[model samples]
Target: MRLNYPFFFIFFLFFINSTYSYSADCEKPIMPSDAEWNSWIQDIKEEAYTEGISKKTINQELDLITPQKKIILRDRCQPESQITFDEYLYYRVDKSRIMSGKNMMKKYKNELELVANHFNIQPRFIVAVLGLESFYGKNQGKIKTMEAVGTLAYDRRRSNFYKKQLFAALKIIDMNLVESKSLIGSWGGAIGAVQMIPTTYLESGYDFDGDDKIDIWNNYLDIFASVANYLTSIDKNPWSSDSTWGREVIPPNNIKDIYDSLKQIDPKGCGAVKRRSVPKKLSEWKKLGFKKINGDPLPIRDDLEARLVAPDGIDGSKFYLVYPNYKNILYYNCSSYYALSIGILSDEIIK
Candidate 1:
């Protein structure tokens, strides 16, 4: 059985209370007048009616939308300086999570195999990601989806993303798959076992339980299937055995960040090198002092181009040999650190 979020309703009550304490300054401000609050609700009603979101959905969602402080903090915060990849992964990949993930692998085997068959995803990797994202659903987060979306829309930092997510959250409630009280998620709006944003959940989620519904919260099979389907939609199952996401080493002195000009290579994901072009065959890299960590032949051949990235960079202890399939990890997240962590976690679990 999949883990269900038990406190989702409590979070909702808090959010509903936050709706009226309209302080514009966040840190220090006065509450909006009754007229202003009513006007805001009126606007929401108008949008709900026009957009086909039911009145029930609008009322329920609005009732649960309290302003959250974390959203404001995340929206306003600037990017911090870089942390070491090893340190990042230390927190990201750990023993207990992987052990729990392995158990889930056993518990959900039949459904996972079914999803893997259709999507061609390696089940271990998917399960590893599941463990990493939400602790196998033990902690899906407590922030109300409505509040986070509303906060983001009002904040104006990445308004397009937040607004789109806001619309998607309302649509989820309107569809009746979730209650407003049940729409709790990460501070950024990722929900349930898969950590999917509301838009992604609505766009591509699946129902493998044969319930005629897609529920990411209560159905383990459906959640795994949805995630597998999402991965396929992003890359047609680029992580399959025939494909390679691992990278070949690059000589530190020889390569420039040419991949910067190669965004056209991805359908939506970035190239292996972000904006740079991929490297040439193993033979090419070998000629350039790029050898395998195992002292064996580099996995890639000379005929193919690979993304050259070292999470540790040139001065670091380890190097990454990237393949086009490896670039597919970025579709899950754009960060090289994130993708590498997933790859490494997948490796650790598989081993």
Candidate 2:
């Protein structure tokens, strides 16, 4: 799976709770006295030492230990179910974000290009991810990652995932990629301008700026490029600049025929991710009575393997013919609806 990319904290929890022992129910709230905090801090330091974390790192992280509501609110505020696409597109993808991205593009053009060229991905795509993730760092999460991860680790609903993230965060400290004291980020552990979690920092982040540290928080170049490289590592073809990330289309009434034809083929990652290998193109979709939202023929790409995706259920208002690259965007965030927002927003930004 893509590791809970939707809210980002869940994936963060996956890594955050690996080694922590639950103390109490976080919501009921037992304000650990200064002495108690100190005791727990020492215990945490011992755990870190056992895990090979340095004394310096443990001390640095322990220095900042006051609790805040921001982290708890993030988990509690997660939508009970997926918000409808209309709501997501209307609220999440706004003109302000697109304008901000354009402004940032102009400001950081040279740096973004260099990073994209080095990473073999598009600068716009990287920019889109930044905009979506944190509005280009406007709201880079505020919770101390160690604390947030620790809280979730103790929550038990996703104890295992949070524990792993906690372990990974410790590893990050040990690696010296980021300092343990530098716990500035999303309500989750996503740090820096691009807002990568510690685990993601370990996996996809790099010091493109040659600053001797992969410091994405302070450096725009490192943050921008690291986000691009992360996407490329997962699937390079999705980074191609030429393609649109699927479109809202109108499909025929009898869409089941196409779905049935594709189901006979047992596929691994693609279908599970909603990428059905429909061996057709614009021409076939048109032939099957598909029409563009604007009531015109879709521009043809005969050779490409296209999938008929109704992001809403079959009876929902819109139909989409998603390409494999669009599926790759879904890899960026697992929800079909989330992917749809990014795809549509990207097209708007580029256009």
Candidate 3:
């Protein structure tokens, strides 16, 4: 065959330009010096004051903090671990985690049931989210919340997001919702057993036990209720008590071809949702050769609709027929891997 040198050269140029663009986006900028950080903090305080945060709260929380450059570095280098869905699931839904989840479910049975009744959500799922986020409240985070959010707010990328989080953290302090000294959490500023950010805590955190505090850190009642509240309050499609998130399945040998034809025509919601096949009745999926993992036929019903998701794509080892409730889990954490882990863990917790 004759060599297409010109075509290869053009492809090389395109590849080089794409790589450079990606590198440019990921490149880290210089960390701010102490003087620069102090000045930035002053500006932040002024903004917080305008947002109605108390002056005392601003000075007390914002004054003594130093920039956490390590957080910014971690944020910039947030690794997208290159692994298959099975490998991801292996670590997230292991034997120990499942056992711990079961134990937590039993230990907090009354509280979990209360939240379940109040929010119309399953108790197992609430436990699964808590277990996954903080390992049953063992590792919520060690970083001081103000310092972490403040440092990230000062950084360039995602400045607005972290800034909002910082103000919310300050507001939480101002309201005396949580003690300032106890306000420590993840490097990214998510707090408490359920690992909610400040804004979410403010909006959804509940005083379920009626101590007049939404103490997600040490209060399993608040934590469980908050998770249930977040799920039930998701706009449009909320969690359905009658259905589970999704189930594992075996797709047809021609799944790729089937998916190409049946994939969502109008991409909606997040990129994850867009990647899934359009909603087909369980009967329809059964007709198309999809079956439960145990080789049982899908329910022979047209009333129920489900979307097909091969998170690792058609060639991967697993596939799911997810329900609308699955999208509610996505609202909790968008990734298929994260949502799937929550679902599988929840299933195992009750088993």
Candidate 4:
């Protein structure tokens, strides 16, 4: 059908306005000029060579590296770190993840048990880490690992840390554990089902299946064993299956003064570290009027020392008498919210 001239003109104007409005709303991120990016890539390639990366691998990977503005933005706007404890827990330890973790526990019962027995780590905690890290391997991220690390290494905000990771990633490729182009992971460069950074992968990843390749991306055995190994490795503090992560407690009225007297500013650790009460024997806490959330007597072991932690501060939320095992969780991910969610989710999975 032939359109009228007036109608055609009106339709053309509407299309143009809509297109321009959308473009304005979704403007592209500003990035360095091509010449600057190219020069940076060349410098990275030279550094990689001095660090003993093969010339062929450097050319194949570093030559094509480009700045990932999207990743830089993501690093700057990490919503998880900014959210409240309750909000973080609600999203991270929801019903679906608990159910999925339980199903995974049942499905991998034998393997989990074997790894647990061998490493003296709890099977449920292993499963919880897997669920939290990649949703039972359902979402291991889609960004190329090399590109993400390389971009962050050049971005200058945390260059020293990301550069270390970038070099470790190069070593991973050089050793042929995974091909550079095939390695995909989070925007910050954490890889595999357990979301391990490159340094951790090199230090603790194991070839559990004895297939000669530590393929955490595809092998559940490797993933589970690797996580257990990381927690129980000799260099790291061994996880004690007999001890729990912590118990929620009610502190005495003078807890604030007590906390102030004992608190140490540990800037290198997680948020929980800032609020950690001085370590006291379980009996001392009980004597000082702290009790379990359910009002039960604290354990009578004088040798068992624990720090009282109130993640949302003492007045706003439940307090916990966190044991060494709780700190072990922080070794995996320093966020107290992340560690608490894993512990809570693991308990549900076992139930």
- RMSD to the true structure for each prediction, in A, is 7.3, 6.5, 8.9, 10.8
Candidate ranking (TM-score, best to worst) = 3, 4, 2, 1
Backbone clashes per model, in order? Answer: 18, 16, 0, 0
lDDT of 3 at 182: 92
lDDT of 2 by residue, 1-351 (tens): 233443553343344344433323335434446686577556666776787767776676656655445556556544333434665566557899888888888898999888888877667777887777777777665667788776665455566676666767777876777766675666556677777666777788888867667877778888877777777677545455556567777776677665566442555564336444454777777788788888887776576656776665665676777766676666656777666666776666666
User: Residue 39 error for model 3, in Å?
Assistant: 1.3
Q: Which parts of model 1 have CA positions greater than 4 angstroms off?
A: 1-34, 77-81, 235-239, 247-277, 299-305
> TM-scores, in order shown?
0.79, 0.79, 0.90, 0.85
- Highest TM-score: which candidate? 3
lDDT of 1 by residue, 1-351 (tens): 111222332243344343333224445323346576566656766766787888877786776565555677644432223456776666667787667777888888887888888788788767866776677887788888888877766455566777778878898878877767778887777888788888888876887767766778778888888877766665353455565457434353443443234234554434333543355666666665666765665655656665567665556655676666665556666667767776777777656
Q: Global CA lDDT of candidate 4, please?
A: 0.76
Model 3 clash pairs are: none
The window of 10 residues in a row where model 4 has the poorest summed lDDT is 1-10
Residue 292 of model 4: what lDDT? 81
Q: After aligning candidate 3 to the native by TM-score, how far in Å is the CA of 222 from where it should be?
A: 0.3
Model 3 residue runs over 4 Å out of place are 1-29
